[model samples]
Target: MSGLLALLDDVAGIAKMAAASVDDVVGQAAKAGAKAAGAVIDDAAVTPKYVHGFEARRELPIVWRIARGSIFNKLVILLPVAMLLSVFAPWMIPPLLMLGGGYLCFEGAEKIWHKLSPGGQGHGGGDVIPEDAAHLEEEKVQGAIKTDFILSAEIMTIALAALPESGLWFKAAALGLVGLGITVLVYGSVALIVKADDVGLHMAAAGRLRATRALGRAIVRGMPGFMTGLTWVGTAAMLWVGGSIILHGLAELGWHAPEEMIHHAAEAVAHLAPADLRGAVGWAVKAVIDGALGLMLGFVLIPLATKVISPAIRAVTGRAAKGH
Candidate 1:
């Protein structure tokens, strides 16, 4: 009886420890998810375009399919690779993150360039015809997955960096939780955003109340602006996160010029503002500086990506131009 009672006590202790570990993982995963907010927002923002030319009925379905692919990308593909990296070659992470950061910078910069130079959308097969409706949907979904792979890699790396120092199992648990949580948050929001117009249309047509119909009309009108705002926000986030990563990377590697300059520059700018507004001013200045730096780095990288990397990728993958 005493031995059985001791066994029960041990089991209870294990359960307690397991519960504590679960709590810790959840908390750490939240922190990790927050760290990857830029990639998360960009993921959601960029996905809608994939469904743009499709039928309204097809939009949510395409998003659902893409979201599924994104989950697979994160969990089945990236998760194992991330775990292996952590186990064996953890030192390689910063360099890999820098690479992803550079890509983000390039993307953000390229977008700005495209906006400035109307004809510059010449890269990335913007000229190609959609083969058919089904083919087009497949093409867009595939493109979304490819893009998700890059952004997911960035998010996973950021999440891994933000994770609390722990055992391999704990780290893996936290990362997996972060991955799952972020995918749900991102794609779920995408689903809602894509469906908002339909919801508004239904309400506008079918609602019993005049005020409800008015609100629905407002929603339909407001959605376009909201989507545009989301795009700009996503772009800004890409720059902020990408630049911060690069700056942090340089600081890690002992090149503190960017970091110190931004810090003092923001502080100097903040001093010009009233006392209560100083903190907000400082943050705005710092973000602006970081984003500007990111844009500059991105601009530099875009040509290399287009002229050099694209050709090499084509040679290696042996894939022809993607018909958009």
Candidate 2:
């Protein structure tokens, strides 16, 4: 009887520890996911365009394919790579994170510049024979998956950087959770955005009440504007997150001046705000400053990326620029 009781107590203790670990993983994953918000938002924003020109019936299917690929990118590929980095090259994480941050800043700034410049926009897809719908759909899915791989790499790296120091297995679990959760959040949102017009149409055409029909019509009309707004939000988030990461990286690398300056300035702004809103005000001020810094860095990088990097890649690969 005594032996059995001891065994049961041991089992209960183990269970309690396991439960606590699970909670820790969840908490860490949530925090890490939040840190990667810039990449996540951009991923969701970019995905919808891949389904454009597809048949309505094919939209959901295409989304599913891309979502599956995103899962593979995050879990099968990026997660293991992140784990390896944590184990073998932990010191590299900060620099790699800064590189990713710089890339995000460049992308966000380029988008803003394009929008502001006259005739800067170009439609996706170069001239080609009209391939079969099935073939074209597959091509788009492949292209989207490739794009997701880059974004997923960024997201994973950012998440990895954000995690507190921990055991290898614990870090892996947290990163895995972050990967899976973010994939679902981004692609699920994409699916909804893609199918919204269909839902609106059904409501507009079939709603029994006039008000319901009007609401549906409004939804249909609002989706385009909503998508455009989302793009802007994503750009702003990229700049803010990217700039902050770079600033933090510099501090980590023994240059604390920029970070300290930003912190003091934010505190000053926060203190001027109403007591209840101080924290929010401070965060917003910091974000704006970071975004401005990111924009400046991005502008500096644009010519280098376009002239030097693109040409070098093209020369090595003997292929045209992957502009998208």
Candidate 3:
């Protein structure tokens, strides 16, 4: 019948529309995820340390717990807050992003300073080891979650900023996809990094073939270097991304000189390269400039944060606690 044919065509059109929407959501999510790569990489690099002293069997469980907390932070807390900001306080996004960017710069710079300074403690130091194993584990998990909240906030804010204007539901779907994908990626990577040594050892001991055992030994040997490399890469990413964000934010706020100068400089560098390589060269130049700027800003902020801001915070919190 003609009526039946009309119904089938209508259903097919609806299906096509639905498929297009899904594709859009996925495309947006991928772009947003890329924008949050610095925070995501930092999250992955930092999480493995929380399980450093734990039993091998417990490492995966701890990672899982932290991953759950991270998801809750991103989806339950940050996602809604980001939505509200987009809906009501859209103007605040640039400043908030700059703040988060500054934080990344500060953190990256501080790590570099520690590496350079004499007797400087690196990551995973200064953790108060409780006598009770359970208590220590709980403390580490809580600490990691707390750290993750800040990073997750940065990630979600960056993603929200990257998204194009759309309906609330569309934004929510894209953001949810970004958050879930990032969480899986970060925690899954952490789980693998933390357990890699154990896995390598097992393979070395239990592998059926000489080649397998040799490969296992290589993995064990390579893990430490791999972690170190990952940390440095994460730090570099933080500096590059943070500096770029700050520059872009400043331009958005109408102080365009810094960005313009950087752009011009990048162009100059790009001109020396072959046409095909020019784009990549320009990007690299920009990244290097941004990272250098971030390092300088971070150094400036270090003393302010350590001597002034930290003390003030402790004083206020101390008084509040005493009052309580």
Q: Which of 2 and 3 is ahead in TM-score?
A: 3
Model 3 per-residue lDDT tens digits across residues 6-91? 99999999999999999999999999999998899999999998998776778898999999999999999999999999999999
Q: What is the lDDT of residue 290 in candidate 1?
A: 84
For candidate 2, which ten residues in a row score worst on lDDT?
122-131
List runs of model 2 lying over 4 Å from the truth: 121-131, 319-324
- Scored by TM-score, the top model is 3
Tens-digit lDDT track for model 2 on 54-135?
A: 7788899999999999899888999899999999999999999999999999999999999888987756664334567888
What TM-score, over all chains together, does every model reach? 0.88, 0.95, 0.96
After aligning candidate 2 to the native by TM-score, how far in Å is the CA of 188 from where it should be?
A: 0.4
The C-alpha lDDT values of all candidates are 0.87, 0.92, 0.93
* Alpha-carbon shift of residue 298 in model 1 (angstroms): 1.0
Query: Which regions of candidate 1 are displaced past 4 Å?
Result: 1-12, 119-131, 268-280, 319-324
